[model samples]
Target chain A: MNTKILRNLAFTIFTCYVTIAVSETPHWSHDEQSTWWAIQDTTQNVPLNYPFGECGIGKHQSPVDLASATIIDSKSLNKLAALYDTDTAPVFFNSGHGIQVNTSEDYSGVLMIGEESFPLIQFHFHEPSEHVVGGKSFPAELHYVHINEDGRIIVLAVAVDIGEENPVFGTILDNIPHEEGGQNASSGIQINPAELLPADLDPANLDYYTVAGSLTTPPCSEGVQWYLLPKVITISAAQLVQLKDIYTNNARAPQNLNGRSLLSTQ
Target chain B: MLIKLFLAVSLSLSVASCFAESDGNKSKSLIDPSQQKRLSTDSSQQKQAAQPNASTKSTDSQSPQNSNQENKPSMIDFCRKNPC
Candidate 1:
């Protein structure tokens, strides 16, 4: 082969290899689908297109400290009605960030705030809780992400306090997929969403702090209404260890409130 | 012959563009957001704690909400006079 032809062929092959490698390797610091560390990458934190991927820039970002909030009368506050099913099995999957419980049509429920209610889409856990109270974090936090007919989002956050074994956590923790992107049907087991709520969690008596914030994860879209249940639900310490073992640091740092009002139903 | 030349030119252009984009991406650093902000501001401050004990048990029972008026009744006032 001619020396010139050989050199050209080598150049072409090298260029092709570089292209393939770059395309195959996920962007380390931006894609939340692959790793937890990238959420910490501030430059790429706000989506290149502002507001949508911009959790850092969004005024109503979530996981705020509830300690500094205004108190209101509880009598006028509406109760939280979680209509969960016991018959249908909920799908549990590991969404790289954390273990998520995907709700089925049969297992679907609605969380009524007042006349407006959001359909319970799915729930997931963040080890060591996301939102803090008095600057104190909990063992875990469960987020029931609800979307309404208008496509608005309202998240119901439950702080999990480690204590006696919780049946709901038992079912979920038992089926946690160790590998990233792994998912499993709960082995045809039916897990009640209501069971995940503390038995003594009376919404009327539950004084929750509300905030207008974006989703904690990527594509942190704004306008998410957060209803944080101060009532602590119990899951065994062993379960907490099992959860942390999967993703040691999946939670994002709480963003600045930017003067957003944090209301409470006391 | 003309068509073949056009195809070759297009292929080379696509490959060149791909290489250019990838090169641009490679130049960007993967610094943590907090660190990146501090660096840009030229401030010498300690890194924010990762809050490792975020999952530890706490006696503080404060739990946190939003203040949208239109969404207010739908969220907090719905189950008050109405059935759950």
Candidate 2:
């Protein structure tokens, strides 16, 4: 055999293996829908897709159209109290769905619900805005997840639109890994969750819609407390496009309100 | 010269045989059982339903405690499009 021919043959075989090894495997559910395509497969899996399906039969599902609800007097609504620390380093994970930033144990940030307080756990983003307001879905949504002592979850969701570049989101998005399933840790940089919100967002003056719903993802567990802030945060077009490239069309369609009341402050 | 030609033909045939075998088994290996099981486990974990707290539940229902519990991946693993 010619030495060059032998070498070429080996190289071709090696290339084949490498290509296959690097390719991502599709993750399918029993209903034959995957997280990547499940939102769009709604027409097929009515039982398993958005609005219904899972361990719980989607009674009060999240990502609902906020515009459909009635607005109450803002003063009558209970004020949200957040004691977020200004000094702390948060670690970010890709989580395949969006960039998940985990709060460290020592962060001491907590969202107070009257007497019961839930510590800030983590926050992630969903593009094209999961919850629709005024018959329009924004470019993105940010969810700040917290948990009480009993393992109950409450999510503080903020809707985002493209306008100006968000400095905090800019810092986070700059370190995002191009490859899926990759996480990067911020070194020597401390980030306060407060920085993620608008500087003018006063908790006392803010009007938000409160609802009881299930987790947007699988397990689709119920009993999650949700508060959707009415104010829209702005992100740059480039930042939105960068995030979209990572998880194109990642937003889950708004679920049926299911006779659920969407209460908000005026 | 005939011997050399025969040697080249034989080498070409061997290379073609290797390619054929890999091609035949590629699909089967791609769906390896271990990988399937891992995916199955993830889907199975989604079966754990959250205790229903009817939509009427209010935030002030529970008394405030200085709870500082750390967050774990107790909920289903989150990814945007691809498998996490």
Candidate 3:
């Protein structure tokens, strides 16, 4: 009888352990960004702590204010070469945080910096812009996230302003799922990410300001290479309304520069 | 026998919780020690190289270039329609 009781007790303990392990994945949101380091659950009157790292202590955080006085003209910096697939259909989703577009599994696109190439993983947007330029904030910003084989990250940021309607951007807005945690896949809509660039700019020799920073979100991992394109892309005021309706002020405020220098390929 | 089983279960839970905590720490330290040292070295070199241009401020709100006109890219009227 004692042996049978022991077996049942062991099984129950194992099940409880598995449940705890799965539930421990930290839940975070932009609602209380100041408390992102230690998110609290006050719904049950008991504090369920979900702590994050680096965000509270990292020296090289991202979304910094880019000013000309602090920027360095690095002639050694190479021009950005982005080789993106022009005909692949990408999946658009609203990930509660922002409107995100995930590249198809077979879609092969690359952002070349120097000799190293980082594969395009996914891209997302931030309202009212994240990185401020010369103390001026734009209507929105787009981040094209890439990752290399060595697990390094390089995020390319483009500032968006209110102007003429961008048909390609409009296609993304039309297909975006209105509700949070919603996704639109297999829409049979093909979007060439290159079209999102400035109409006059060349993809092979793009000019940008490079800096070392971290992820704006939780865990806020540092050592990410940031490439901020100085040129701005245009979207109509109505399109801005469509984006804001889905996510308004969904951007983390600019963090301290912490003595980081912006390197530009002028 | 009940006391022994209870102790074993408690020990297991402690170890599992430790593993979970360590996983979070691991993600925070994704860049290894060698890479961290290399990054610190590169940052020092960049700071030294950028010292010359750190003091020159320009009033041009449209561009990120300083008073050095040679470094400025040819001004393209890309945002003439919607001047921010």
Please report the candidate that would top lDDT against the real structure: 3
Candidate DockQ scores, in order:
0.01, 0.01, 0.01
Query: What is the alpha-carbon lDDT for the whole of candidate 3?
Result: 0.66
TM-score of each predicted structure versus truth:
0.61, 0.63, 0.68
lDDT of 3 by residue, A120-222 (tens): 7677888988887555678998888876554556788888888788898888888989887687888998878878876556788887767777778765766
Residue A145 deviation, candidate 1, in Å?
Answer: 0.9
Deviation of model 3 at A233, angstroms: 0.1
TM value for model 1: 0.61
Calculate candidate 3's fnat.
0.00
Question: Fnat of the models, one by one?
Answer: 0.00, 0.01, 0.00
Ranking by lDDT: 3, 2, 1
Residue A190 CA displacement from its true place in model 1, Å: 0.3
Interface RMSD for all numbered candidates: 17.4, 18.9, 18.1
If you assessed candidate 3 against the hidden native complex, which CAPRI class would it receive? incorrect
Candidate maximizing TM-score: 3
lDDT of each: 0.58, 0.60, 0.66
TM-score of chain B of each: 0.33, 0.33, 0.33
lDDT of 3 at B2: 100
